[model samples]
Target: MPAINAIAADKLVRLLGTPRSPAMIDIRNDAEFDAEPRLIPGAVRRAFTSIPDWAPDFGDASVIVVCNDGGAAGHGAAAWLRQAGADADVLDGGVIGWVGSGHPLLDTAAVPPRDAAGRTLWVTRARPKVDRIACPWLIRRFVDPHAMFLFVPAPEVAGVAARMGATPFDIEDAAVRWTHDGELCTFDVMVEGFGLGAVDGLARLAAIVRGADTGRPNLVPEAAGLLAISLGLSRMYPDDLEQLDAGIAVYDALYRWCRDATDETHDWTSHKPAKSRVRA
Candidate 1:
């Protein structure tokens, strides 16, 4: 059993893709981080020595502290965060344990530069349907939990991205860093780029995203359903931001279903239909 103060890595992995996921704080010392240079999915690096300075900024959300191990560093950081009136816990066994258990880790070097507010900014076409909404969900859930999104008119996407130093995605410009690559949707590119393809649920979710975004519904069982909902969401909200906000919840449900309940089935029958004893 996990200790009262620590959460198991498997349980945390289940929570990582949802909006209710705790804020993951990597408090590993510089030397240790320099060796691996990757991050737990959705985790942000914070100097362990400066928890007092940074702890106050996390008041809006609960926090999880990760160190080299679930030892003194993480436990102490969680203690300090709790003292500061935030719900906090240490990741049981930290980075090593996460790796040991074969959970996916994001390649932090592929992350875009953060703005002054310490959030990644991404610009994409307004009136998003599938891929655009899915990409933001991936970023928020696994890449940068605090990433910012900017939705502009389709014609102005590249210009706004350039002026604001935001990465433009799901647009059709050869110069843009995040456009479609051949047959793959932007969602597929992101999954490959971030090294998240190893995640079984995310891989399944990616196939659905690709099929929905690329007009290839035959590729995945859920693609047609996702495409319908995404298109409906686009029509429902005139404000692009509102549409994206609502779409996040849709993807959240799909992700959780993929992760936890993919094999589960239901029917009206209390037990398997009487093997049909057909008038033998």
Candidate 2:
């Protein structure tokens, strides 16, 4: 049985990629981190000794504290966070337990530098359609929940990235590291770059994104539908940010479908009486 105020690794995996997942704070010491520099997807590193300073940043968001062994450091930091009025729990077995469960860990080296507020800032072409929207959704949901995006004119992407200290993505510049690679879209590159390719549904989602963004919707039936929705969204909002905000929900549903509903099928006949249903 798990300890009080502790969550098991298996249970945590179920919540990791979803919007309802708790804020994950890695409290592992520097030595422990340097030894194995990977993180649970979406977890942000925080110094356990500085818990008093950062605990309040979580506000009322539920949090799960992680350490090297799901030991004292995790429990202590969680306790401090709770004392600060944030709902907090310790990971039952910490990073070791999570790895033991065969879950994928994010590569910390792939993460870009954060700004003063600890949020990754990205600049991309304005009036984004498919890949642009999908890439941001993946980053926010799996990499940095508080990541910020700046949509600017195509010609200004590199300049804005330099001036604003934002990473430029989904552009054709030879210097940009987050753009397309061969046949894959930016979303595919990010999933692989972040070590998220092995996560349950991301590979399938990446294929759909690649297909839709590359005008080869035949790659997956869902790709065509995604393209249609993305184009419609692009037309719906004159403001790029507004379109991105709306596109977030679209990808959320697609991801859920990829993760949990791929095997399931739906039709009006599914609810119809067996006797009344048409026999093909």
Among the numbered candidates, top TM-score falls to: 2
Query: Which residue runs does candidate 1 get wrong by more than 4 Å?
Result: 270-280
Candidate 1 pairs with clashing backbones: none
Compared with the true structure, what per-residue lDDT tens digits does model 2 show for residues 195-247? 99888899999999999999899999899999999999999999999999999
Residue 77 C-alpha lDDT in model 1? 89
Clashing pairs for model 2 are none
What does each candidate score in C-alpha RMSD? 2.8, 1.8
| Model 1 score (lDDT) | 0.88
| Residue 244, candidate 2: alpha-carbon lDDT | 94
Give the residue spans of candidate 2 off by over 4 A.
Answer: 269-280
**lDDT of candidate 1 over 1-280, digit per residue (tens):** 7666899999898788788889999989888998878898899988988888999988846888888878998999898998888899999988988889898899988899998878999999888999999999999999998898998889998789879999989998888767699888999899999988887588889889989989898888899999999999999999988998999999999988987889887765424566753333
